[model samples]
Target: MTQDNLWQLDAHDIARQTTSGDLRAQDSVGAAIDRMNAVNPDLNAVVVDLSDEAMARAQALDASRDAGTPCGPLHGVPVTIKINVDQKGQATSNGVVALKELIAPDDAPIVRNLQNAGAVVIGRTNTPEFSFRADTDNPLFGRTHNPWGRHISPGGSSGGAGSAVMAGIGALAHGNDIGGSLRFPAAANGAVTVKPGLGRVPAWNPSQSAERGLLAQSMSVQGLITRSARDLHHAMPTMIAPDPRDPFHVPMPWQGRALDGPIKVAFTKNTFGYDLHPEVEAALDTARDALVDAGYKVEDIEPPNVFDCGRDGYRALMGEVYSLMKTDVDAHGSQAIQDIFAVYFQEFPPFLETDLLQIMAKRSHYARQWSLFLEDYPLILTPFLPRPFFKPDRDTEGGEGVHEVLGCAVYSYAMNFLGLPAASVPSRLAHLPQGIQPINIQVVARRWREDMAVDACIAIEDRVGRMCRPLWEHMASS
Candidate 1:
């Protein structure tokens, strides 16, 4: 296969070729690195390049193949890690310049898990500072622009992973979601992302100690971003292997079972209190129609309280968890921490003692409500965001106010807070400046129900087909 073709093949296809001896692992890794060099300068998706190490690992895989040694499922596939995850020698910057030099001494559990499953970590992708906002931009690595349009954002905090996948730099990239980080960017840039239920894929930072509060433990989950839904199907099982590092890591059986009859989908065009832009609404309508035509029962309903959970409880919990990083920031470097906090304090006032208690109380109540809601509705079909795509902004300004992009977080952040498995699936191309016209719907199920989520994605893929990526030629100069 041509080098360009190697870059475009999904992880499963690459693995099949390598396992069958049709393609050598080293050749595939070299081609992937070359493609990264060819396109990264224009897109800036990958912030750290591990070309040498990746090539070495690829060569080892080839030698093993020749020696007739059995290989793991994802053998020799090139992938990227979002910089927020620990990958040994590299720092998990999380877009904070002050912590850029804070090197990780060991591979994050998920990184090691991927490596054990035979995936190569070719590089680290960019993220927003502390992943606080929806758009991926920070002083450390600047911004991850959409491959569809340089003038727009790729979505954060996994924006880099999303952009890199769209540019055909990697078949898969590791990403974690605390808010909409994984899903929105996947939606923004025409890719697919799964925020597996908490502990479905163990997440830990060996460089730092454990989190301290309810929100701290509740709001975060780790998973992958990829061009094809099948990549996630392959990754979810491998990544969820038992890891003692994350206490929350569950050994629940992956639902590798058959889909339970025709799937039931609940579609909500607008968030509870928000308006969906015409393009986004139309894209969602198209997806609903497609699902209906595919013989799945699609019902339009008020997506249960996801918006209120995010606005009222999720944000409060996230603020508390993020504040825990203050010590890490202070010990390593404090200037950036102070600057970001200054902005944060200005925007959202410190909660009164009573207000803080109220937020915490509401969290427990909200979690129960969401649990009951998911019992009847096995799947949800909702827009990832009200807007089709957002343009690049130097800061959250313009007459739209902080709430414009901030408000859209409800569609994604709520699932993270609830510890439910959710996915961002692009429905189709629409009239968006990003060229990759995309609509993302969050597919949710009970905790540890990732198998159901994947099945829904496969169902959607069988119906709509995966998003058509930009040709390498079109994105080469992007």
Candidate 2:
């Protein structure tokens, strides 16, 4: 492989080459750093560059290989760590200005797992303030622009991870999702990601002062965003490795038992009264057709009450935020974020006190319904958003903006609430008058079946083709 284009190689390919002595780990890391230097200026995707340390680490890995040490699956692949998570000497800022000076004393589980598996951390990515908004911008890191163009938002909290990985700064980008953070950025940047089910990937920040709410712990999950679906197969296994810090982490292997013959998939286009954009509907049809072609039995059947579940779940989450983080947000957050949260409360009124507890308890009822529905159909194909991704700061337009961006996105966050694995992949690249952008579809798998969801994403990707080629072509031309 040419050194100049080494940054474009996926984690699987990079590992194979580096492990077989066909490529040098130092060269691979250097190429990625060069790519970050070349493109990251305009994008602002990577806020903290770790090139010096990454190069030193890559050299050490090469020396270890020369000394006959057994290589990990990730070998010498470069990956980015989201700033929200601790990484030993780095700051766990989570895009908040007040926390910018708060340094971490140890590595978060996700960081340790990735580095342990031989993936070098090249840099730290940005996020929205408090990591709450759908768009990526903060008082600390400013805004991360979409690689497609500035016309689109770099979908939030994991926005920088999505942008950096897709822009060739890293082969894999570590990102966590509480709501739609992982899939939102994947949809925005045309990347592939599987939001791991509850306890699939262990998570904890050593620098934090207190424990999070029960709902926060249950809904939040650590995951990765990659440029190709096949990359997930190579990287996610190591990511799910158990950590002692998170006692709740499941010890199950990444690959589960293969289902008998063709898997049945439940398909739905129900937008919950929101107007389903033609492009989004086309994207769903493309995914359905792709699954059918891949020998999966696709049927048009709605899986439980997604609208009710999504609404109640987010409202419940808002209540948790209100009780737990509201004061901090009010005190430390910028006016823009404060305004966004104000709109969030208006859109999904929080249930307080006893009502909050009752709604939290009702989570099982929704999960149970989806669990039964998945028993009949192991996979569900649905629209990630009712339309193509919105423009930057569209969320700042007020109530209608929040409704358009989040309210219409019932399918994306519903999986997060249910604590089920969901994968997002591009099924169509819509050529709008403004510019070409990818349209993504969501695939929800049964609990602890993230492997299944990724498999379905690969099947769809096989038909629709990967998004990186056109994206790179655009980047080169521009």
Candidate 3:
């Protein structure tokens, strides 16, 4: 591929060619940097550019290749790291001005893993204050616009990762998900990602002075966002590499044992009490049709109670936040974010004291039920959001806005609480009044079977096609 279009290729192809000496690492990284410079001004997706160091690393990689040094699996593939995670010398800013000087002394596990696999870091991406909002904006880095248009938000926490990857800034963008962080962005930007089960990918921030609460430790996960679902298959193995710093990390290989017979998938249109938009229903149908055509035995059946599971889990998480984080948030968070958190507390009232403990214990009960249900059906297909994604700063409109933005996301956070792997993939690209946007559906897999979820995402993608080509054309025309 020519330099102008090199940024369009996925990480797998880039890795294959670079590993075979058919492509130079410098060319790959330079193309990404050039693309970032061209498109990132409007998007604000990348907050910290590391072009100089990236090019230097590329030169060193090329020299090693010339000297016959062994290549890693992701040789020369350009990637972006989320600013909340550590990267040796870069700031783990988490989109807050207070943490802008919090330089990391060492690489976080995911960062070191990507380096070990020969991926080049092109830049660090943006996030909301404290990385808690469902849309990307911060006092430190400003707002990250969706590549599609200003009408829709670039879904947050990992909003930058989604927007950048889909906009062709990098083949892969690193992100983390606590609630619906990864999936939300993937849905908003028409990208693809699988939120790994608990302990699947080792994670820690070297700049942090205190440990996270129990629920935070249990629910949050590290993952990657990419234009094509298969890119996750190529890159996620390295992300799961064991690190001594994370004692709870599961030391497991990427692929799990093949299930016998046709894989069964439990499908549902249950939005609980929320009104399911026609566009969302259409997207779910498309995904279900694609899966059935791909030889999956898709069935109409409800799995576990995701609504209650998600509600209680989030309330319990809020309880922990209330106890441990309110003071810091009140002290350092922007007034906008502070106001959003106030509404958040109103929306999901924190389960206090013994109630928190009880709900935390009940998490295992939900996980067990899901585990048993997964025994019958290896995958569950559901709506990632009950409607199309909302506009930027919708969460700032108070309780009604927060409900619209996050309340309907039962299928998302429930997976995190249950510690089950889930993949988000676009099934439809719709041109709406605001702008053209994608509608994505979630595929929840059995625990530790992130591979299966991504496999289904690949299948759905094979039928519906990826959003990158259309998104690129749209950006060009705009």
Q: How much does each candidate deviate from the true structure in C-alpha RMSD?
A: 2.7, 0.7, 0.7
Q: For model 2, how does the per-residue alpha-carbon lDDT over 146-231 read when each residue is reduced to its tens digit? A: 99999889898899999999999989999989889999999999999999999999999999999989889999999999999999
Cα error, candidate 3, residue 432 (Å): 1.4
How badly does each model clash, as a count of residue pairs?
0, 0, 0
List candidate 3 segments past 4 Å from native.
none
lDDT of 2: 0.93
lDDT of 3 by residue, 1-478 (tens): 6768999989999999998988899999999999999999999999899999999999999999999999999999999999999999888889888889999999999999999999999999999999998899999989999999999999988999999999999899999999989999999999999999999999998789999999999999999999999999999999999999999999988999999999999999999989999999999999999999999999999998899999999999999999999998999999998999999999999999999999999999999999999999999999999999999999999899999988778788888889899999999998788777999999999988999999999999999999998999999999
* Candidate 1: tens digits of C-alpha lDDT, residues 1-478: 5766788888999889999999888877888898899889878999999999999999999998899999888889899998888889899888887778879999988898889988898999998777766678778878777877764678877889998987878788888787778886888787887888876777778887555466656677878888888888776788888889788788877764555677677777766667667877776777777777877787877756777776665557635744665565555433544455444444444443577678877777876876776666677777777776676653356325445665556767777767788888877667555455566776777666777777677767777777744435456554
TM-score of 3: 0.99
Q: Order the candidates by lDDT, highest first — what do you get?
A: 3, 2, 1
